[model samples]
Target: MKNLNPMEVELKLALAPAGPAALTQHPHLASYPARKQSLTNTYFDTPQGDLAKARIALRLRQVDGQVLQTVKTAGQGGGGLSQRQEWEWQVPDHELDLVALADLLPFQGQLSSVLHALAPQLSTDFTRRSWQLTDGLVNPGAIGQRSHIELVLDEGEIISGGYRTPIREAELELKDGDPEALWALALTLSEQVPLRPSDSSKASRGNALSNQHWPLPEAHSPAEWLHRATLALDAYHDSQQASFLSDAQQALATLADHPALDADARVYAQALPGGLDAHGQPSTAYGNAALALAHRLAYQTELR
Candidate 1:
């Protein structure tokens, strides 16, 4: 697998404090034993953030006693699904091998210069408990086609300037199954735990800390917040039809009630009468933020 640049396709779900406990008790997960590990990742970039300028992330991760360096190239990610190009290498020690990275990056011959200017930026420290799941005998999906999935529960925080943002999240990666199976598992898990789709990656979030800015979606840009919010809303509706009406309304209300979103909600309110929900939920609020909001939230999410 290391011979190829894998397309990292996965979904991230933000969870409440009780999610890990509930998820551990899930029947499907309970059917198998879980593998647990603590991961400490240190991200690196040039002083002025050269790698980030091109949406590339370089990291060294220490798990147990082994060290591995990873380089990730940005790609489309939203609505809980992410697809990125990633290169990983096993190293004897905690260090970046610029010569190895040059073989993959489009840095011409300047890869060394890039590394010379790089330094540790920020870190994501978390405990990950993972289960190897299979679409088993009683599940509706075909067990033959939906072969395997890696269900990971992560709990910890992103630290910067001695401040920490708690992280309680889960990810379902299709290791040997139809990508669609990931959604099915997500839907099943959401029933037991409160979840919101995550649009940003851990690396991206850590980068934000280096800049001394907290990337609160609502606080920074309502328009972008609206876009990401709508994506999460759509996915949630797709996840469970039983609570669509109530949940969608609540999600819309969250956007409208936020001080940052209220003004934009009003401004875009009139032009989008057609987009309003039939249940009379504020369609203008979501429509305006979704259709017209700037992509600033994305920029901030990426940490450039």
Candidate 2:
């Protein structure tokens, strides 16, 4: 295991079936070398879901036959960008290493009592193809000065009981430099690939599958509306359910008239209807609009 920042800042994007090929062939990423890995990750929680109730995720991942334990707290901000506190360590096998975790968790005995009863609830098996991008090369005088990022495309499935949800997404993690650069890079790549900013993580998706419950987002403001619309778009793509598309249309309509919406953002929201109408069909225009919506939502600060 290598040293990593305790704070994890990353952007997750929902990808179309052809998104992988489009991104890999993009001019900015084509010349760079890439690496592939097979990962199996199992998530743990108490029988009563104590850890999930507390918005904590405990996972054991097998990478190249080496096992790693990771714990992540509930993060803030969605639609594209999120920040959370994470702790990871290497363990001998696929078991909880309480001794190592004891030094990292904030409350000792309170959580430890439940940790002892934890069991595997769900797992994700996937293949990841990744690339490392450095400053001054990809963006050439881009904003935020210099930036470093790890871009990965993940494909696989989330399995729990008899249900399995397919996984096709891309992630961009800030290795070093300005966080603003993430949105910039995503925007440039999204122009060619069909991408939608996502708030759903593998753990959340598995949990949702286990319980068979899909909830809708509540929106009161422009920023919240954007969040609702983007999540709806992704959900529609995943299930091809008409209700999700209706939800997206409603949210977009609200955002189109909201007083707080930026002039530039309103244009994206207005253009989304054409893409939404073409849902369940194949068209890059729909993806371009979805990506544009995500980009605008990521920069909204009114929620604060």
C-alpha lDDT values of all predictions: 0.62, 0.77
Residues 41-87 of candidate 1: C-alpha lDDT, one tens digit per residue: 88888878888777788889999898998888775655466778887
TM-score of 1: 0.70
**Cα deviation of 103, candidate 2, in Å:** 3.1
lDDT of 2: 0.77
Error of 1 at 174 (Å): 1.5
TM-score of each: 0.70, 0.90
